[model samples]
Target chain A: MSTAVLGAMYEGIKHIFKHTFTMKYPYQKVLLPKGFRGRHLLYMDKCTGCGICAWICPERCISMVPVTDNKEYPQNPEKRFPQYWYARCCFCHFCTEYCPTGALDYTPDYELAEYDRELLLWSPERLSRPPTNIGEYQSVFHGKDGNQGVTFEPVIKQKSK
Target chain B: MTTEPPSPGISISKTAEPSTLDVSVGPQHPGSGHCRILIRVDGDYIVSADPDIGYVHRGCEKIAEYRNYVSNIPHLERPNIADAIHLNWGYVLPIEELQGVVVPPRGKYISTIAAEMNRIMSHLYGLAIMQGVFSGHTTIFMWAFGDRDLFIELAEMLTGARLTYSFLVPGGPRRDLPFGFEDRLSRLLDYFEKRLVEYDRIFFSNPSVIARAKGIGVLKREDAKKLGVVGPVLRASGVKYDVRKVEPYGAYADLEFDIPTFEEGDSYSRYLIRFEEMKQSVRIIRQALEKIPKGPIARKAPLVAPEGEATGRVESSRGEITYLVMGDNSDKPSRVKIMNGSFRNLIALPFLVRNVHVADMPIIYGSLDYWPVEADR
Candidate 1:
């Protein structure tokens, strides 16, 4: 029993000098993979107002709204676009898969926290705007255990993608 | 008042018997999850334990009737989101059989990878919870959860979601392998392998843990089968039954892995079984990645399935997960019944806890690895 306690303590102390596993969230963030599904980014030009994304959403979070801007999308006569309610969105990205026009895409901006519930709903115009101040951190593996430790090198990027 | 001499080996029923205290251990207890256990105790020893489940029941089967075939994927995986791929496969495989949609060889390989990844994650999560229960060993708990993040990160890289993948569609996986996946996976596997050794030295080999767990809740081989316990609990009781081994599906038929079983049937053995399973999962992942072939990931599936009832089964992280999906020739399924492993294993809970100390309750409970949310669902 005494030996076991001492061994466990040694194991714990061994990690003291090793780098911490957690990312310093607001300051340092994980570098998400290429195909990460985070926040919805809408392309108004290629959308074609089909509402396939709205139809395919299991949560019924996406609704088709009439487009007021005719100058931006001259080809679209349907005068409709998708407005997303983030409150109900499960972020399954099923809509992205079902989108035939390839207009619906996801940006790796997972931080969707807001002060008000009403502000959670994103209009087509709001969804079209790109994400700002995205944090990208490079993961460096150190130590021989393969599990020994990881150090995150924070790489701040201006572009969302 | 003079007391009569205690009967040898047996006690006769009397008009006025010694009263046993009934203590209800939670719907609110942090250790017990959403389910409650009503225990009848004679002093410190439990006389009887009755599990009261269904706190988190959301009528998952009933909800399956309203949604279309594709839409049901996300909802079906909700029962045990940690092992979502297995649940996803259980539901999708039946739908595939009904629709005659054959997943290609590559798709099978990828599914195997994702399933194994989910299994490792699920086992780690269970171990973390079990560690917490075993004398508040917060070190192992933190280590397990921290390492679990590695697998979760891999899952997110592969399937695009952290918790609910919804990656598997009826025909095949929603997406193919991403760039730099194999390299990242191999490194993580090596690290995880080393961590397992550390875990053994710290938690499993700890003297205090063994004293509490060993011979505490011994479910004999006969009793295990009789009680209909499934998963690690069943395996720990010496029944070498794994649905993957019995009926191989997807890439499991082609792959090679051993089903770890223990004869002891104690809480310690159950803990060991999970660790062994995690190691096996790692082996399976390495093999699948090495032997993965080049082919179409998915076959073209129809929007609607035919009118028929088909059953699909898979070895989930917990145990055998079987799905009975009945399609009414519509876009939606007429009925979907999910038989999860946790519910099947719950029958042994009362038997195991009986005659055991109140302090050993958490160890026995955690050994069973019963997820009340999955059971209730």
Candidate 2:
């Protein structure tokens, strides 16, 4: 009985020298993997005004609205694009998958917090900009002494498309 | 000031005996989720426990009617977020049957791997929160949760999202195994196998935890059979019943693994049952990765289903989850009924919680690994 208790104590004490597992969120962030279902990135040139995204969206968060932009697209003669309401979107990526023209793609931009409810809605123009807050740290494991620890390494940013 | 009499339909009278006191354990978060156990206790001993559930009811069945077959994947899986793949798989099986869609051999293998990985994650969540924290062992809780996140990262690598992976569609898994996935998974398993030894030394074999759990809530084999408990709870009671073994699904028929069982139906055995199952899950995943065939992962299934009612069952981390779907030759189902393990195991809660100490209540509750949200849904 004494040995068992001492064994448990020894295991607990052994971890004192090991590296910590958790990260300091907001300051330090672990890089997300490829094909992460974060936010939508729309390509204006590829979009053909097909409402398949809006129709297939389970939450009905995507709505194809007419863009009054000055830029003309030969593919999208109707000038209609999908505008997303982030509040209603479940990020299931069904919209991105069902888009026939491959116009919608996934970007690793999960920080969608907004103060006002109205600001949660993203227009086609807003969705077109690249994500700015992609983290640079990747979680890597050290192989020595069976001491499981994460070491951050520099990440090469890849285009979401 | 005048005190108003009790309302006509409501009874304000005390239900407990003169010596016993009625204590409501929760309508709030009671370690697990929102579930209130109205226990009638005399001194330190509880005479009876009546579980008050339905606090997290979201009318999942009713809402399933409004959505199409594909959309129901995300919605139905909300009941058990920890074991989302199993729940999602259970809902899809019936739709696939109704649509007459068979997943390819490779798709079955991938789904099997994903499901087994999910089983490990779900069991780890139970170990961290249910057993570890309830037993007041903070170290095990931290260790288990940290280990679980490694699996979560791999899950995110395979499926797009981390937890609520709508990875399983009607025909098969959404994505194939990523590059270097096999090597990474095998390495993680090796590290996890070492960790399990430390877990056994610190938590399972530890005297304090064993003393608290060993003979606390002994449900005999006959009683377990009579109660119709499913999953690890039933298996711990020495019933060699598992949906995977009974009605083989995915690549379970192709793989070789044992359904770990314990003779003792106590809280300790329940805890050990999950531990053993995790090892078996590891074995299953390794075998699946090795024997995986190279072929088309998914077959293109039709959006609509024919007019028929089909029932499909999958062994979830908790227990057997059976989904009954009735389609009317439309995109949406006419009716959907879910019979999940948590709700089925709820009867065991009131049965076991009786005649035990008030302090022993949490240990027994945690041993069952009952998720209130899943039960209420």
Best by DockQ: 2
Model 1 / residue A140 / CA error / Å: 2.6
Which run of 10 residues does model 2 chain B get worst, by summed lDDT?
B5-14
| DockQ of every candidate structure | 0.59, 0.66
* Candidate 1 docking quality: incorrect, acceptable, medium or high: medium
**Reference-based TM-score, model 2:** 0.95
Model number with the top lDDT: 2
* Model 1 stretches with alpha carbons more than 4 Å out: A70-72, A145-147, A155-161, B1-18
The Cα local distance difference test for each model comes to 0.86, 0.90
By TM-score, the best candidate is 2
Those runs of model 2 whose alpha carbons end farther than 4 Å from true positions after fitting are A144-147, A156-161, B1-14
What tens-digit string does per-residue lDDT give for candidate 2 at B230-318? 99999999999999999999999999999999999999999999999999999999999999999999999999999999999999999
- TM-scores, each model vs. reference: 0.93, 0.95
